[model samples]
Target chain A: MDIFRRNNVTVAGNPQGPTVVLAHGFGCDQNMWRLTVPALADAYRLVLFDYVGCGRSDLTAFSEERYASLEGYARDVVEVCEALDLRDATFVGHSVSSMVGVLAAETAPERIGSLVMVAPSPRYVDDEGYHGGFSAQDIDELLASLDSNYLGWSAAMAPVIMGHPDRPELGEELKNSFCATDPDMARVFARTTFLSDTRDDLGRVKVPTLVLECVQDVIAPREVGAFVHQAIPGSSLVTLDTTGHCPHLSAPEATNEAIRDFLAGLPR
Target chain B: MIHTDQQPEPYESQNEGAPDIQSHRDSTPDAAFAALLEDSAEELYEAAPCGYLSTLMDGTIAKINATLLDWLGLERDAVLGRMRFADLLTVGGKLYHETHFAPLLRMQGDISGIAMELRCANGDRMPVLVSSVVKYGESGEPLLIRTTLFDARDRRAYEEELLRGRKAAEEARRQAEADRARLQDALTVLQKSLLPDTLPTIPGVETAAHYHIASPDRLGGDFYDVFPLDGERFAFFLGDVCGKGPQAAAVTSLTRYTLRAAALHDADPASALATLNTVLHDRYTGSGDPRYCTAIFGILTPGASPGRLTIQLASGGHPPAVVLRADGTAAFLPTPGGLLVGVLPDAHFATAETVLTPGDTLLLYTDGLTEARTGADRTSLYGDEALLAFAADHAGKSTVDVIGALTDLLASFGDGLDDDTALLALGVPPLTAQP
Candidate 1:
């Protein structure tokens, strides 16, 4: 169905500049990257796409079995790269999509040049030696929240965007607006995004990676960012003063500046 | 699908935080209050912290905990005196209470492990577990039936997870079984893929071959190859591989090919199977896995007399071929002292000359038939005595008739078939019928 599509809004900065792909987090399609996208377009050719089973993509293309593992979604990233035939593409993914980009970079290092992860988590569930913020019990509670009242939860959660809700920033309103889609996709996407565990492949990423951590995100807490930084070797981590899960949504100017600086410093 | 009966003003619905009602504080205070006030019946039987309820024989609200009343949105008036217990249950719950629960309780005085739903005061349905017991009066009369219900929200979530896991496990198992059967069927189809749809009838030599696979669950171990070698010389081989399933089937296919290819190198039946033995030994030796076969390979040369032939037989570990004599006596022909076809680096095969006179029969079979057992009496297997008796009755029978009857008899044995069976019977017409 047309429901599975991502309305990719392509923007070009300088004709000679390098290419960069932007990925939005859960509860949002590519449209949520609007504020950040305009700022990045001045220096780079920006490409963006929504994850399958989200946005306007074909929902029929989404499979419970195939997508049971988010690795398949990473594989989709590689295929999208191939379809575009883009060379040395730098990937910038937010929240869960950040982790997905990490996996995609690990899977196809030759195609992707570098990774800019916004509040990534290598694994959400705790392991023996590592604590990735949330416990298994906490995840269960989140799923219970979805089951209890999926619509009410989005309504309750939409107001929980980054920065002050009374005087919401542009990025916050963009995120709050992103949460206004049909709720069924929200539930399915939540299971796909929040419940994923991709820790085992973090060390395999050869590409240079940078994880932007929000100092106080209830979802994908700062501890999870530390875990990701530790798991992925030679990876630079910089903590964001902006609170909440979406730094790009709350502090787009700083978020865009951070991403631009990271990309500008990368190897030609 | 859900309705709430409480009509409190939306403004007064903020919650007072209790230790248990922490998350409930995010909703309305009245909701948190209802949680406590409605849980009375649930608190009764459902082990303190949770809600519990019980109903009488005539579906009356006989017992309840304080926790449930807080959940039901009722003040005891609407539920205690006026409503029946069935009224509290959802449509599916009421149906289960009448059919599976009630009848089981009446017959066994106890019914446990039932999942149902409770209709709350606001018409909201809650999942619950109901277990009941019937208490009999001292006068031997049916008394009140006691039913206990525990709020099953957490349990329902847990059960749904378990059901998903169980369904996934069952699906994996079922797929494995299906793949096993599909492989065997594919092997059988591949085996038939090699065979000509109909066998070429040798002039002056009447022939019939039947291959029986005891179980369809895996590939059969038995294999037979019959084809013309050269002018006036016809060849055939009946062999049994050492095991079952895909591995043995692979060996059977390889052995058939090796025999066919090696026969072109040497016309002797003994030499053909000798090459097959070397191939099997080399493929499986020292791998901690051993593969072997038992076989009886034969060659036939037609004679001047109508429907007469000279047959040379070379056997390896397989049972001796049965010769049904013209005079109505069946005895195993001596081709003993032969090694298993594919065990050692070098193995020897023994050849014996046997003549099937007019009205005679040659029955070549795998050991599966002779080892079959019926009931506890393992002695009553498809033994030598029974086969001899069967041969006497089938005197002067055609080759086709003999093989068909044996096939039907093998099927009748059912689970008695422990291994694969292949039977090939060739009968020569009586001299009196010859023109």
Candidate 2:
């Protein structure tokens, strides 16, 4: 199987420059970084791809036995790096993909130079001594919300609340687009994303890492970002004033600048 | 103009000289109508069935109806500019609002029928169903979120009852699964009891046996045993009962006990099978359910000459026993024209006599081996020809070697082996063993 075709890998920017891979979170595809890509495209070679079962990736390649955990997704990340012939790459991951980057960097440390985790939560469900910000019942409600509002919610509300007042077409394009995957696959992906616990894998990260916490993010709260930063050795934490789960989409300027500063400060 | 027309009494009071008609009374229609309109609008806003509110995009409360304030037990002044909608909910509800509700509203524009619990001024929780829509400005930018909430006391109570019922059902399902596993365990123990714990060793013969269970959940009806009948002689039997489960197990136990007793009594394989056939036919003849089996009974005796063993075998509708010679050749020991045992009052069983020389083996197996599917498509069976070829390929091997090859073959079948099978191989030691 062709790894690029399996993951729908797309390459842009400086061909000879060091690679910067942008991995999107759950409920979204590669297009989620549409707002932040242009900022880093000039100086860095960008590699963007959708996880299998998202975007234009081959859906037939999905196997239950192969993708039983986030490690399977990390394997896809490693394969994407190998397919693109990239080295010492910077991995920028959002939401669930943040933990995915951690796993991928651990898998092939030589391939990844640094990691930028935006609004990352290593776990979502609450534990004995930790507050992952959600109870089991809350996750159930979220799944039910997905069930009730699959495509209908997008058509009904896309124009009003999506931040792009100047370009409503962006919202319209997202209606049954972007994260428009098979509903069954989406449900499985959601389960795999939220039910995962990867806090133990953070210590294995050898690459320099950045933890970006948004001011009012409901998904990954301040404490979660702090916990991630404390877990990864020598990782820097940047708290953005952005007020939503999606910092790149809601506040692309601050998100891109923070990433830029971190990449520049790296010992290249 | 209507007020001026209806102001006859006031006009009369002003002009006291005018006529005072009986129907001409004083009236203040303008003031009364103005007061009524003002009272109704305020009343409707204060006491509507559903609560209504509008909040800024960041969730700070701007305007709220009196009905909502009353439900929360909070004064209008205290809630107006102070708290966001998410702040009013319980912790779990707050998390849900932030993760699912807020993101969904931002991307889609409206959310409805969401279940949440709002905190009251008294620190009590109130269950409510909420629906909200994002209002847009002329430029399509979000202006404010208009929301409607309904008191869901009855719905909550009903759902709680439903939840209790669902929990009970789930408990019942788990209990049923546990009970089923216990039954399967019991069945496995019962099935093991019918087979030999260990094959009894003869002075110069080696033996090995294997049983393949298609499923552990159900009891298989195959049985094999080797035991001493009398001095210098031993009896052995392997058979497949007609069906599975408790009834077939009963017949298998009865057949095994009867064969051992009959062989010990007469020292002949043919007589032993005859006794089993008679007992089974009599037991199930008048009963609605009839049990039957295909079986082979054998009696082995050390040869009066050296480097050999004498065997007398009887078959009742069973596959012919196979023999592998020391000279690297294999052939079937023919026991033809036999009928299935326990099916008839006088069913005839055939007897065959053979000798096992040094390094020769005699193998007996059930139909499951030959009938197992042999291909990925499951269209081809590991038929009698394949079994014969397998025996020929390992003709000069010992009992353990033959059983090992058969074990590999069975595993290679994988899910294709859909039936329970039993294999028994008895071999004489090589001639040079006693040197």
Candidate 3:
């Protein structure tokens, strides 16, 4: 149960400087941070890792009962910190992983110095007083779409070039550079991410936090980000002019700059 | 090439700087045939079976085939420069396209067979299968995305049929699971009916019992009961039927009632077991899947003095009972030469007589306690010797204490306890019974 091997932990950049952990969302791995990592590479230590049952992390370590809720995912984050002996680290989480960071910070408050949530939604299903932009039936349809399309995704996205059998290292490079995930793991992760409700966990944050809301995101709307900001005390909120849920991929420069500005303003 | 005066000009080839090998270079038949082939290239592109289109890296449609434009019911000029490929998709499909498909295509260089529905110009929706590849330049930069679209009308109909079949199968499976759960609940209730809801409280004797079911899905044959026979005597029996399910449950009920009837008739443990053996042998002879049982029947009566009790216990091919004394001593009350009941016409049963003094406990359990598999190998059993040692270690314990410790021992076995266990313990208190 080595956490580094369990989560495919990768450490880069200035090791002596402040640590920034980048966590990917439901459908992707740590490679999603490729565009944003370089923006902070000169000033901070970059820590990247995939959750269990995603990317190159050990598939044998997955247990359905253990991952039925986001708390189990938070346990993984805490275990990673414990394994690396990281303290006062900044956590950058995208989509569902943002709530995962909130839960992790609640668990070990002294270990995390701050949090940055990008395009986050505390609840995806619509409730009585809140509009999360998705219905239960919509979520069910999304799960069905995943079921019908998983095989196609697996065969087409195996990270191996179609005509390059002679150079195996090229395939290895593609595997490391892209989001290569097992189909079954991806389905379970989608269920765990979209079906989770952790809005109550947001109010427990005592550290300095930043909420980055994309102006036109389909997955997490602007109001949801504003709700997160209002729930967590003394948290700063910034609205990005990006048009997609993935600002890191679609608008990396703006996303990175917003993060940099937020980090620079924090009292280290 | 025979290019007649009626044909329009050949459409321009999109590839730049290509050799004009298909043109009429010479007047030979080979050259003329090549020119003829070149003349129909635009015709093929316009009326091809599949729809083809090219888009810029930012998803703007740079070119499109005539077949795709015909399907959308739109003019050529309206779509050529006005729409992104994602704009053609439905709202949900567009979301999925942006979130998963676009990112994958950008990173992986190719993606295929993505299911999506396209919103046509006339406000009608059409289901389509799309496959796209990124064309790279000499410098390894992405130039354009070439996508081929297949009309999925027949395919969608077939998929709807398949979806209906799959949903039916899923409903049937869910129904079967719910049926299995309800049957398990009924069996559990029937099994519980055979045991006393609460052990009858004897003024001088303290009694406790525990039943360990290996699985809730199947009924276990283990049964135990403590019921009074008369003013001064109580009858108790603990046994295990050979198999599980309703048949074993029936046997368990028969054996329990038969033991009570025989004990009430003769008020002797040995004669009661003999009657049960005769009844079971008579009922199961010449039957399909013959059933049998191992039992230990006992009669309890208060002695002449307080804090004293005498018991006569009989075993029919069952494990011997254990006695943990008040002075920290433990031993098994051996009942030897007992044959399995309902197996033979003249099966023998043996009786053991023991006294329960102050602070002494007597334990009766089925073979599940001794024959439980131990450790990871699953072949080594927690044998009778281990049970004897366990009894010795927990000596001078009350009835509840003994039962609780045995329950913990059963739990420690985890998945190794493959059979159900029945435990009954009776003790005489050192002090006043309720003080």
Candidate 4:
């Protein structure tokens, strides 16, 4: 299989610079990195891709069993890295993708060298004394929320959102469009994201890691950020002065600066 | 008359002098109507039928109309510049706002008619349809968001009803499919009970048989079986009962067992068929739903000479059996003037006799094969002549080889062959000299 085509992988920025793969979390696709892409494109080789069942990735390749867990998404990352034959490339992941990057790094240690987790949460549902900011019932509510919004994600609204008369250029740039996914596939990804617990895998991280959290994110609170930081040995944590879960989109400058500093500090 | 004329002149002079009274009467109502229209713009915004709110770029409520505040049961002091737009939504709606709604609005600049629920101050959920547009600054940067909410209580209730109806229909369809699958499995097991699992091997003869079903859901009416009558003689029968499904299958089961029992009593092929005919006619003739079958019963006996067998067969309105020779010759053992079994109290059965030496075979089959439609238009019958010619081509082959070739031919017919078919080939081993 052509992993690049299957994953809808796109390469940009300085061709000779060290590679950095940007992975979006659940809900949105690769377009989530639009603001951060411009910040790192000058000196870093950037790789962006939509996971299977999201964005322009081939929907036929999506298997419910294969993608029922986080490992299937990690396999996509590993395959993309192998397809590009990258070694020691940094992986920048947002939200649920942060844990996906960890799995991919462990599976193919040579492919991904360092990690940048943006608003990362190892688990969404709280357990024991750990505060993941949500309960099992809350995750069920999130799934219900996803179900209620299925009408908005339907094809009837696609043309209205894509063909904005004021922004005609958007139609050309976003061919498969943004944040639109098959509702069934989105449900699987939602269940996998909100129900998964990856905290046990945090202590296994061997790469240079940087965890960036929003100062006041409802999805990933400060306690979760500190937990991930302390779990991964020698990992640095930076709290961006942002209020939402997506600091890269909400506070692009701070997120990019923290990412760039982490990349520069890594061994050549 | 003179006095009335004088009064009219005086009244006319008074009316001409009072024109200002008419203008005063017209201007009074117009002034009152104008006063009602004054200072109503702010009142319209606060008292509009639908809720309206404006938020900063990050969803901070910068402004809200009294109509929306009334719906939310929140005061202006508590809402304005204090709570974000998400704070007013239920938990599910808040997640929806963060994941799909906000991202789509950011990319498209406007999103409309999204179904969502708002949590009122009293903890009651209100279903509402919301539309939002970003108010951009002069530099094309987003400055704030303008939103409108319409009550969708009636629409939501109707949609819920439709959802329930659709879910019920889907469940019914799933249950029907599962029931069909189970029924087919039961029919297959019952059908197997009416036929032999494997043909019994004769002392010096090679035997092969094949049965094809037209539909998996309906039980086929065709059955065939081979069993040893005694130590030296073997009895075999192939037949098709009229009609299909469970009733015909029951008759097929009865016909098979009757033939076996009759053969044990009297090994004559004609006598066994006569017994079956008697049983079927006695059992079904009294019922309104009468059942009948066309069958070929045959007996194989060791001949006086070694490596030779004597075959006697009787047909009851069945197609003639074919005989193939090692000399590349084939012909039908025609048993004409036979009547369909169970149709009358006494039915005439046509009997034919033949001897099978080394390198000779006998074939028995029902009409499903010869009656199969063929050709491009599917208007032509395969017929007995075609079967004779096909058997001639495989005259010198073993029973297994001939049956295997015929199976392929049946498969090639595809949909053109839409009836249950049974084929049985019994052949003798060809003589070979020592190498």
Q: Which candidate is the best by lDDT?
A: 4
Docking class of 2: incorrect
The alpha-carbon lDDT assigned to residue A93 of candidate 2 equals: 95
Listed per candidate, the RMSD to the true structure in angstroms reads 21.3, 12.1, 9.1, 11.3
**What RMSD value applies to candidate 1?**
21.3
Best by TM-score: 4
Model 3 score (lDDT) = 0.81
lDDT of 2 by residue, B233-271 (tens): 888899999998889889989988888888878867778
Fnat across every predicted model, in order: 0.00, 0.12, 0.12, 0.41
Off by over 4 Å in 4: A1-19, A36-53, A56-68, A75-89, A152-177, B1-41, B302-307, B429-435
Query: Model 1, A1-268: lDDT tens per residue?
Result: 2211333334456656788988777655666676687888878887777666554444446666666567767766777776667678999987778778877887777778899998787666677887765566655544443333222324344333222337544333332233333345555666676578778778877788888987765566777888788878898898877655667755667888889889988989
Give interface RMSD for all predictions.
21.8, 5.3, 3.3, 2.3
Clashing pairs in 2: A157-B108
In candidate 1, residue B353 scores what lDDT? Answer: 69
| Model 1 segments more than 4 A misplaced | A1-268, B1-156, B162-184, B190-198, B355-358, B374-376, B380-389, B408-416, B430-435
Q: Between candidates 3 and 4, name the one with more favorable DockQ.
A: 4
lDDT per model vs. reference: 0.68, 0.81, 0.81, 0.85
lDDT of 3 at B429: 75
How many pairs in model 3 have backbone atoms within 3 A of each other, for residues 3 or more apart or on separate chains, i.e. clashes?
0
- What is the TM-score of each predicted model, taking all chains together? 0.42, 0.61, 0.65, 0.85
Number of the top-ranking candidate, with DockQ as the measure: 4
